[model samples]
Target: MNLRTFTAVLFALTLPAPPAVAEVGLSPFAGFRMSSSVDIETAGASADDQIHFRDSPSQGLALNFDLAEPGKQGELYFSRQSTSARLDNGLFAPGIESIDLTIYQLQFGGLYFPGGKSYGGFVSGVLGVTRLEPEDSRYDSHHRAALSLGGGYQFFLTEQLRLRLDLRGVYTALNSGGSVFCSGGCELRFRSDGYLQVEAGAGFVMRF
Candidate 1:
């Protein structure tokens, strides 16, 4: 080759290639969640009531972004659960009024799959905020810090589609204090506490 042609070829070879695009995935899921009942205690008083919350169904969606290393990902998710509550102590009359409670959560976490591709097990840890909303306007809503740890398996149906089965244990702290269930001078004061809730579900994931 001539001198000019050789230099041109060298320059072309030296040019950097385009940056690789990151992989992203989205998963939407629906499943059942069973929560442990919380015992309400009055501060510096013996009077108390146990709030029994029923098991209810839950649903949520998660977004995943692949990291530089294979099998590692960052995720953002949201979930909601609805259920009814009953007071064990006769503090409130039975069927006096219906109380409906809804729990909402917003989370961010990381997941690591043993195998780089689909059809493997993955572990995850998430930190988020949980909000409790009551149907009765008389009672106030609460928001607290929450954490979740779990693992699951993903089965790839195709190159871009997968199914996931997951089970996680969630813990939330309830430090927001107020008059929860009270009547007349027989008012009950609540303190800060925490509770553990378990969740299991399946989801359909789409990779891009």
Candidate 2:
């Protein structure tokens, strides 16, 4: 499929479910994510063609406010998650060994429990802003809008604590400030200039 068609399909597939009710609750969450592609695309190459960039396997924390009704459809939530990464060139290279990233996201979406059982699962989508902290010697730091789609399950462990497993594919743009390109090469950043991330983490939810 073409790029536009593929992107459209992806977004459609990731749309959030409608909320079940109109209620609000606060929860804290944490998770881990692994990068499937480079955070910054080179000036003249596609993410699929590049190598040597450091990959990230990160830990994250989030605070979520879910709003919806009780015991019916689904619930929408507003949440922010933060994670960082350090690039490693892996060859004793002095200049490109590390780049730290602290990503912040604000998402408004909801989750569903298809059958309404004691233990259930859900899916969600989040659109928000992300901030990247580049290494001192590499590219400049940047902030951009990001989109995410993922899902998780909730497990009740006690009267006050519920465990959750969440995951997503996050999309963010590449910084083009000082991008370089060969005399005859394409402008490094392609039309599809973002990376994909798959993350999983454990969090807890409480009812009061």
Candidate 3:
């Protein structure tokens, strides 16, 4: 079978069957997140070259539901998280910045909460779409299939509000037909490279 077919099957197997007994009430919430990181390694770099960084402050709405109350076996959930990145030159060129990268993810996996309710931690695997826009135009964009593995926890501040901390390891790279350029008589080429991101924030959930 092809990769797509294999992935579909893998995802199916990863999904645990619904609990036989009635499950706990699920609370869904939306929130904003901010993240920052450094590029460990990238392809096609000059000896004296650098990432030519930029400022990328992102904000997005996220939704997640408890599969079976706060803690239980065979409990799983699905979530959709998205964010955008703004790029700029680190130091070589001052006052040069651009808003060029946008990221979106659709994740499906299972979570195991050892704690009964007060607080808990979880781990999951996600597959989704990722992209980068060297330029801030719709057509001049590059897209790719991406995957992530992450974990987080929840602390109940009140019945209606809670604090959540999520950290994710993302993998994606430059696709063909896309290119990078440099000035100051510097020649640079960028191949596909994976990056890491860490996010921490709070959320307010409304249970129905």
lDDT of 3 by residue, 1-208 (tens): 9999999999999999854433333434343434443232223543322342333334444444455455533322233344333233342224544333445444444445666653468664566666554443422454556666667786666554556556656555444324443334323344335445443434543332
TM-score for candidate 3, please give it: 0.51
C-alpha displacement of 48 in model 1, angstroms? 2.5
Task: Return the top candidate by lDDT.
Answer: 1
- Poorest stretch of ten by lDDT in candidate 3: 72-81
Candidate ranking (lDDT, best to worst): 1, 2, 3
Cα TM-score per model: 0.80, 0.58, 0.51
| Order of the predicted models by TM-score, top scorer first | 1, 2, 3
lDDT pick, better of 1 and 3 = 1
lDDT comparison, 2 vs 3, better candidate:
2
lDDT, candidates in the order shown: 0.79, 0.51, 0.46
lDDT of 1 at 20: 50
Per-candidate RMSD, Å: 5.3, 17.7, 15.1
Local lDDT at 135 for model 2: 36
